[model samples]
Target: MHAWAMGAAVLSVIASGAKAEEVVLSPSSAWVLDYGDHRCRMTRAFGEGPTRTAFMLEQTQPSDTFSWTVAGPLVDRFGKGKVQVQFAPAFDGFEIDHDASLRVAEFGTAVASVTHEAPPPTLISRTAKPRLRSEPDALSDGTARAARLRLLNPEHGRSIARLTLTKGGESVSLSFGSLEAPFKAMNACMDDLLVSWGMDPAELREATTAARWINSVPLVGKIQEFYPAKALEEGAEADYRLRVVVGANGRVSRCHMILLSRGSDFAQRVCDIMRREARFEPGRNAAGEPKPAFFSTKISYRVY
Candidate 1:
């Protein structure tokens, strides 16, 4: 098999929803990882020159999710409606909401962040709580990719390299070679992020029974009223993430805005609402005693 076909992993999502013209963007740069105070991001460029289209994956704390976004000039041209992002050699594909994000349809470097039910957990979405879903409803893109990357050892050249993007019938594939080091760095950075959040990396996996969002419907309704006016005017959307710290009493202590998809501000309003109205069944330690714990969730908001 050719190098391109070797272990080709295609990390694809519709950044914008306006049907793309005849354009195929390929890999231009190596994957770069950034360890920020609140998040871990891994980015790569597609399209041979000027970094026209770039793919970004960011995770704040250790979770099966990413603020997966694709940016560049051509993004605004993508068509609206349903689009699919595929993780090959394993499954066919899944859908992403393209009605917003890059749909701004303006010229010059448009940024589109899609609201997927799962992003990484497929490259972005309204982050869902980490829970057990019966059967396949539980298997997510982020979860699958993380699992695959972790097992990238012993089977070295079996995971990363040359991810392809197939959108609107135009084919854009990457030429990545060995994700060993990049993935290693990304994972290490995530561990550090967890620690920064006052969370122990080793204990979080199963340390406490995962936090639960028990009463949140009213909060979501209130959030719809706080849509940023700037974002509304530009037709921009969001898949905002929140890090909620639940006390042992099954109450929210505080909240943090970890990721914002749009270029405007609505996170404050949403986080404020969450802190006041959102209630959860606090997580408990292995001893079945109430213990403080935090969880990150993706909240897709709108003005309706």
Candidate 2:
């Protein structure tokens, strides 16, 4: 696809939302993650208390050099967490293991750590499943052309290539195939290598489906019950995440807390109320059908 088309695809993935309870407020700043930068928002809720927090970083290089920025409520200790990051050059995934060091300064004390594990390996074959049909890598004139580059790892049984899909003006990249075939065996394999990089169609579908449910489901109107808590008070807030079921009838069928911030009373209270009151618009399938889907939400307690 053209550069604009690719930018649009990336933009679509960034715009996602989950309903927030009375105690939780959405971030005014857009959560932007570039190839090098990363951010995470965590929340916690208990009884009638709720709190939300955010962690931010701007990475200069995938291998090294990054600036860390943290905001939201203060906490006593950090907890277990996992993070995934995408690498560039449009390869299937990142080649080097990314180890992160977190430094926290609180209450006149500074604490840093490199205990978290490195970013996981992104094996291309792990995502390949049912492959797509291949035809001549043609341009608008409908002529076959030579392939420029190919990604092949016989050891892992995965390969893809870049071919001139269209003529010079409208050329695009397409990704296909999981198993390793002679690069020449596939007519447009070279073209695939040139344009499109390694991608996991199945993983893309699964992640997108789950993300759609979270974004489309409406959790604003059904708030059956609600109350405010002090855990969200400037210096005393927290962050948290929750897994919820958006029923076909546009209501939250069930919800469970996923992550909780230490001493975050505000997060807990907001979560309880959300579980009781959140509503969904329900989701439709390709046939214009409505179906129950899984969704998730994150909340943070921040000072005004």
Candidate 3:
């Protein structure tokens, strides 16, 4: 799990520019994941004339985990953009769901956006292995690092990530170790970085935002199916989302839903399954404070 490979794996996904409308201006993409946790956030945006278009995904919460991808044409694609997304709970982990999309048309100063959608099933892992590729560049005034990380379907070996890192005039070709175990690759990179700074992973895990992962099994499953533009009506199967917090005791302490299907029973079922199977390891904050952090996930219902 070298830094070069890891960074490549994680960045590949972002580099795979989804087919955005031509009207898009200064379009950008972002991916964020919680280490060892099943939650991830992805956002994309572009500008039109007076409006903009945006797509956001937030997977994993205290109660469940799910994912959705959507796009739309908007009036302007600039300034601040807002997006809404949806998915299913971890219990309802087997189903197709519908998500939302937003668009805008302007170029402002904001650089990032928050989104909610279920993450890819393969990305959900207890450890991450991110590989980064770094190259040196020379400019008239100084030198810099250029990098890219591959982000993609780990099981299928598809390149889904491409990350770029630049210092001064040179960019670091940062990437994940491989297209496989994106989560693990990231973990390895983070660990290496901490160690390089003469710090321990445990020390950082303890003080910063932390989560006590119980069970700690690698849920290496593939996405069996994907439903596009399908909506749940009444008992006709529902859509839900959940976020879980594994405490130091190795058990689920909190389960929250960012979205739910048509029934309360759906939400309850999601919580029940997670509580029965989740695990954890005691965590610490940046200041070496022992506490339980949060890991969010999403789930959807399917005929499975």
Candidate 4:
């Protein structure tokens, strides 16, 4: 079946509003749905000429968080370590901070789960320990091409798109169909599930805040030194957004690239450099007292 068709089937099932403890199966498609126990989940498998890739999203009760799972033949061969998943349009990518554990299912499919949670500070620091590497190895075997899927959370309108998995320097993209229907269906299922649990759906709304940089840190020198040589040769120019948490002492405690115009490696370099070199004066709360704050900024890069 076509990938987009599979995605549409999955979304249709989700939008059907399955009741508690009921399973919904799409006709002639690899999509399945189960709603119960204060959670709703949808699973879809996309097969392409002997290669099958399965993706699942499960959202628990009373929390705005969800766990995403991807399983396939390629994942079966991955080594245990950090795996980077970069979503398309170039902005949505994240690293699976914890090691992936292989799950052997009925047909010997390998599955890995990445939960949406911040890695421990020590663990983040450890993995982020600077290493002097030139350019990232290019994917020569055409393993990086696959169908992309995006899972949208209805409550907060926040979505995560699964792109390609990079583990131990080898990367492979999972195949999926059109994500629009699936995402919408997932959102509908979530809304129904939330109502079934006797909770206000409004509780899932995302909150916003305004925090300004009290002092700016100069990053041009570091960017110039660490900018990728290949990017320079290609005259690649891009913009990146870094989300950082500043402590009361005016030092950045945690940071990550929330948006990027280039590849994941470049985003990592920007964050690493900023984390080590950037400093700020503490931001004040509404009452004028020093407080830890969240800050974000757009950094633009040009070869010239």
Backbone clash pairs in model 3 (N, Cα, C under 3 Å; residues 3+ apart or in different chains), count = 147
Q: Give me candidate 4's TM-score against the actual structure.
A: 0.42
Q: Write the per-residue lDDT of candidate 2 for residues 7-49, one digit (tens) a residue.
A: 1111111111232111222232233333211112111111111
lDDT of each: 0.52, 0.28, 0.34, 0.46
Error of 4 at 12 (Å): 22
Worst 10 residues of 4 by lDDT: 139-148
Per-residue error for 199 in candidate 2, Å, reads: 25
User: Of the candidates shown, which would achieve the greatest TM-score relative to the real structure?
Assistant: 1
Model 3, CA-based lDDT: 0.34
Stretches of candidate 2 exceeding 4 Å from the true structure: 1-234, 260-263
After superposition on all CA atoms, what RMSD does each candidate show versus the true structure?
9.3, 22.6, 17.5, 16.4
lDDT of 3 by residue, 51-94 (tens): 34343333332111123333332222322333221111111112
lDDT of 4 by residue, 61-178 (tens): 3233455676666565565667776544333667764344445353244544434543221101211323221111111111111101123634233232335666664555543423
From the highest TM-score down, the ranking of the candidates is 1, 4, 3, 2
lDDT for predicted candidate 1 compared with the true structure:
0.52
| Candidate 2 lDDT score at position 192 | 30
By lDDT, the candidates rank as 1, 4, 3, 2
Winner on TM-score (3 vs 4): 4
Using Cα atoms with residue i matched to residue i, what is each candidate's TM-score against the true structure? 0.61, 0.30, 0.32, 0.42
